[model samples]
Target: MSNNLKKNAISLPGAIAMSIAIMAPAAGMMFVPQVVAQYAGSSVPLVYFIALIGSLFVANTIVQFAKRITHAGSFFAYNSAGLGQTMGFLSGWLLMSGYFVFYPQNILVASFFSSQIITQHLGINIHWSLFSIFFIVIIWYLSTRGISSSMKADLYFVGAEMLIILIVVFAIVLQGGADGHTFEVMTAKGSPSGWSGIFFGMIFAMMTFMGFESAATVAEETSDPKKNIPRAIWGSVVGMGLFYIIVTYSMSIGFGSQNGDEFAKSILAMDYLASTYVGDWLRIAVAIAGIVSAFAISLALNNAAVRVIYTMGREKVFPSKLGITHKKYATPVHAINAVGILTTIIALLMGFIFGPYPVGYGMLGSFGTLPILLLYVLASISLIMFIRKNHRDEFSLWSHGIAPIIGALVMLLPIYGSIFPFPSWPYNLVLTLVLVYILVGFILGLVLKRKTQNLVQDVNKIISSDGSEKL
Candidate 1:
């Protein structure tokens, strides 16, 4: 087995597929709009629009590092390259921990939807664990086959789900929705608490775009890491941002913004909107799209998470056993297996422990979000210091200095919202858990520093390209 992933195995569309799939546009649209609408009132579109702009700012910071560093560790490598190897290892540890935590959210979603479809349509009350086990088996198998194969699957799954979702969105536009096409939903005035509501809702809006950076995680496998990676990152963020806004806008109008109280509570918002605006057939189509979206996201996470582990292992920052790749498939087999086992363990444990829907998904999802959100905040700071030290001559105030500072600051809004005012019960426990995890990472960093002659070298030994190409 080789330590290197299959280089140039993924093209631009394949890379873009990884980002879009993790987002699970259809599933995100079905679930997130309602969650945001609770905070935004009827101004869900406005919140998403705000999140889009914010994401772009942060995306710029990520693009800065990605253009110069291509590695499977993604956030870890970028932070290390720009901030120093210590911060880099911590970033990798935190990001991988986040990925490991978030992996089960996808499985929970897939199982929840699968169980719902089976129960509602077939009247077969099967256990949710059965569906979860089935999907994990499939997800693990696909991931071990190699990224090119998994990404091709991602491309297909993303296309199908988006098509069904877009059809309903278009229908809503053409028919002027339930209350006629209106711009109120795009205005802060429609919010329950005006700009405050809309801005707060932007926190949830940002989560829908959570995995857009997964593209960078597969940089080693992607074609033209320096050029195509930037394109894929920007393309997925902007493209998905627009996609989210349109869907939220359509749903807002379709349900009538005045009816937001009801819209904000619908678990299957897409099914209701499709049925009322289009027909029952489309409602079923949207539901199917949600299921496929869940599956696609699970696969995307499986691919991205394993690669992060594989790179860390190859770098010797983690157990080297995780770095081993299938000689024939050129895939990270051991890391793939690790993610599969962990996700199933976490999903099954949490699902049974807290009930999969409200408590399990909601609390764990929010917790999983913190580390990655912190990655963005940390990466933004790293961008400034990295460019200043590494490419002093090329650094631009707008591009490298002010932009990242703004990006890092804006990225903190969600972090603030996540804890401030203090969340209830188990959610509050996330704070303590996050602190403990970071402390553990810090202690691990100290031990590694003592063992390795040069911690930086060991932390960044894994490489893709020399990263000298002008982008």
Candidate 2:
């Protein structure tokens, strides 16, 4: 590792900003509003609220973990410190699995936008899978250069995306007032299914909010880790949550359940919402912004995944070659390449199986959510255990103890809904991916454990022979 490169690379604000932007894409109006509305009906905003509260609890646990022990591996290291080596390895593997699967998932979103925009405007039909592969390759190359550059690009993309979403929200609210509605589909009283539906709907809402805890993965390179990690976690929680509620509220009014036929036209929901309330030009702009958000997310995921691999390699859990830092680029070249190649292959395979464009994307997005949730469950448990054992002074019984236990149960509700019964096609696909990841991770962790054990034994022998051991 180049000490100078690491020192010069990241700042507290920059890291926080990067995390916010990366997370911001998941809360895009076009993304969250429709999904929430699908399950919760007029009560979509409540789902966002429920998920936000769950996220805040999870965020607190993560923040406490980050404050004490800063590492690039993030939740993996936290669980390891709190639980033990085997659980830590499992956490790291789960995180790695999510990061790897999620890269292709985001690219699928970008490709959907790319294909939709082109076919709609130019009336051109292109090979979406091939085009998506090309798009992923370009991002992989750019990411191999440096995370700083990737984040710099994200600054622009995230900004444009947020601006467009804000405009759409404003237009929707204005139209709602004109149509004589208060835009408070948020009323808990009217919802027939009530909080039951809201909680159920929140499973998907929480899926969209997966990347916030990811900020901790950058701690090794982030300046002022203590302040920035906490700020990034809380700031993202509030910012993304507010955005989700506002956008969903606007969409509910725009949807206007008054006319059954018109309201059911939620398939082209964003297009209809924008054209009806905003304008055709504004709709075009929002579509463009959605595309940019997808690209920025893809770049950010690539940056995070490569760093996780590098961290694991340095600890001798993964191959050491991935730990090599490039002298010129100050990036993890091998790790970056590994992510790129794997994602490209997965994208190709998925494209073949699912057909092209939007369908493939829906599958990837759904499949990717399961493993990410599993990782969160592990992290939440690790926080409770770690605080109870290591930092008993900093945390009390409720914050570290009861909160995490409840948090874990809450997190699992979504995972259980996803796997055993399989709610939807996307849910089923995601469950399969999660199972595959666990099976592979179990085998790999065993091999790594043996290798690590040998290294520990050698070190112990050296210390004992040198008479440097207290025992």
Candidate 3:
């Protein structure tokens, strides 16, 4: 009946590894390669660097936020505590929506890649949607098992994924494709868009690095969050940023100066190019990496989303049943089920809504990027406010105030660009989800609040007595 709950079952290393598994999804490197190739074209690696720098500001805000609050809901709770109730609820709802999207988005990616491997390796033709459904069910089952199981799986996935990435990089080096592709491309100008292309392409580029701040949300479960969370956040940012830069640059070079068409296909489209350089084995390995990468993203998001819903339930904002933890598994079974069901429905509908292209993949990715940036934007403002009003001792001018203020402003750019009219389908899909989510969560939260308030209050009262005030 006391306020404290059991800690996150995963260790700090496992959490970091799991977090890396989440953030370093190999699919990330493949996402904007075409956009970069199309607009920035040869200069796409520069876009990666540009995006990495911008993403670093967001990562800094996340690390700072983590230093202050150790909440399972990450930026949602941070925004709520730092800003106010309404904004916090909005933030939580937005974040929850983002996390919810992660499930389908990832399943789409995994299903697609898994199908590719099956078709290529086994000569079996299966529908991607069915495979996607199968993968979702498996991911849900694994998620319901516990964070420890998920994290352990992540360690294996992460190792395999990274190996494939290294193989691709090594292939590029061994082939001696381009002497200065990575550095020289930045200086080349696009056809009509020129620098504007890179600027706009930067939006897509930044999205690839979306999961770097995931460590903050899992802080409550970490063993020594104060030290570990901060370290993990920053370490993740720099490490993952470097990884993106290397893989992106390597892939572009491996594709050769004239192979823009091949690189334009998808993030791992270069895996085909890798075959030319390193042979068929590495290409198959890369496909396996993609599947694992997608699965890892699902694992991380499921872990975070379940915790978010459980936090809401614990706070009396949702049904208390959702707050229940499985006694044997010690996992948030109900919350996991709720999140899984919601994500699966969304994924199925997305398939119908957008057809074979997997609208869920792009829509989920875009929307996920926005709420995260908004959370950072709000967090930056909150940090400034939090320092000015309460903790003058925490103020270092740059660390507590100006840096976050600037960080918030910079983070706002993509959010603005994303919602504004763009010719891109991904942008519009993101915009639709953002507006739809806010409207849906607003109405739902209001109704759920009204319905659950008395119940939660009554339950809290009864639990406080431990039989003294029997129902």
Candidate 4:
């Protein structure tokens, strides 16, 4: 196993594109609006606003870490540097697990949209599993081609996704909304559950912005990582933050603020908005955008996930095969292939058992969100601890201390909401599954610590070394 990766393979724009593509604003708008509307009503934008601020705090913590350490492991490296080897190993496990769960979710989304678009426009009804399988192949190939290829593909997908969203937004603005533009949505007046509803909606709203920090995952591959990684992190956070706010507002007004109930009930809110504000042609375009968004996020997740596996493998925390990169491409070929195969299998099994929609919108979607949120909370806490112990002289009250604390606290609200008023069946069980996964990782970490003897020291050495050196 080797720690070497293709150096300076990603430029600043590429890094930013990877982060934004992972967020998949098109997919977020397509799926999130109706759910958010159900809870926050016309205040959907407000929920996004709160989510944006919270995500910024998380992004800030990540950027601070990025400035110091450049590694393929990203959050895993940050955790190792800030906490210890055990915690860092667990962080890698948790993140990898989250992506494993999310891969099926992405597949389901792309499949669903692809099927929907074909059935609606072409009058052809293809099963979603076919689309899922098709996308799996595409993602696998792109991810294995290396960071530069994946980032380039992401750039095109993100551009198209953004253009479609902007078109819809501008159309809504020009024509005016159902009840016209108003500030009432920003308040609790439009929500059925009032402030509680707003808080509840924020849980889902925050999920829409998940993966913006993934820019840090490519630190080893990015040019001038110390400068570009932070820019990418902030760029993705602020860029998507504004995108979510404007798009949500447009959807709110497009659906008519007074028609909150109808909007909440809409399963295809984005398509509905397109039809109402633009035309049927635009509705088809939104569906295409959904497919592109899903693909982009899948690629981004693969890129981030494989790197974590590569780092763990290099450290002998997981299988060493994952640590080895493609000699030609310098990509984590084994890890990428493993993830692609596993994801395809999971997507098929879930689709066969629960049906595509349930696997897509219900189980896989709900399962993926909590684990990632848990990672955010852990990462934020790690940032605070890392700064206090190691970088006290360089730390600021806000950037190092107060910000991460706020970020962790803000992140906790959603984790609590996901569990506590827990819904029925599968969702209530997701937390238990996540706990079991973490426990397994903990035990493995303990075993590795005993076997490796100097695991923590090795991790510290890796973090402390110059970026150009191979571990």
For model 2, the local distance difference test gives 0.69
Off by over 4 Å in 4: 1-3, 451-455, 462-471
Candidate 1 residue-wise lDDT at 422: 76
Worst 10 residues of 3 by lDDT: 462-471
Compared with the true structure, what per-residue lDDT tens digits does model 3 show for residues 1-471?
Answer: 222335757677776775687675476764557666766666677777777777677667677666656667676566655665555666778777667776678877787777777997899998778877787788788877767777788878877888777777877776766544445654544213566666666666766676666776666667777678888777777887888777776777776655655566555565766677778877777777777888888878778788888877766677778877777676778888898788778777776667534455776666776766676677788767655654566678777766787777766665665555454766665677677877776676566655444433443353234323311
Q: What lDDT score goes with residue 443 in model 2?
A: 76
Predicted candidate 1 versus true structure: per-residue lDDT over 1-471, tens digit per residue = 887777789999999999999888988898789988887877899888878887898899888878777767788777876777677778888888777877788788778878988899999998889999999998888777777888999899999999999988998899987789888898886787777677668667877888888999988888788788888989999999999999999999888878787778887788887888788988778878887888898899888889888887776777889988999998989988888998999999999999887678776777777787788889999888878876788899999999888888877887787777777788778777887888888778666753322434533443223544321
Candidate 2 regions with alpha-carbon error over 4 angstroms: 1-5, 177-184, 187-196, 257-265, 424-426, 450-471
| TM-score for each of the candidates | 0.95, 0.89, 0.87, 0.95
Write the residue-wise lDDT of candidate 2 on 79-113 in tens digits: 76666666677778888776776678767767767
Model 1: ten consecutive residues of lowest lDDT? 462-471
Tell me which of candidates 2 and 3 scores higher on lDDT: 2
Please give the lDDT score at residue 434 for candidate 1.
85
lDDT of 2 at 167: 77
Q: Please give the distance, in angstroms, between residue 124's alpha carbon in candidate 2 and its true position after superposition.
A: 4.2
Report every candidate's CA lDDT: 0.82, 0.69, 0.69, 0.82
**Best of the two (3, 4) by lDDT:** 4
Error of 3 at 121 (Å): 2.4
Tens-place lDDT per residue, model 4, 342-427, is 88888888888887774445677676777778888889989888878766788798998899989988888777777668667776
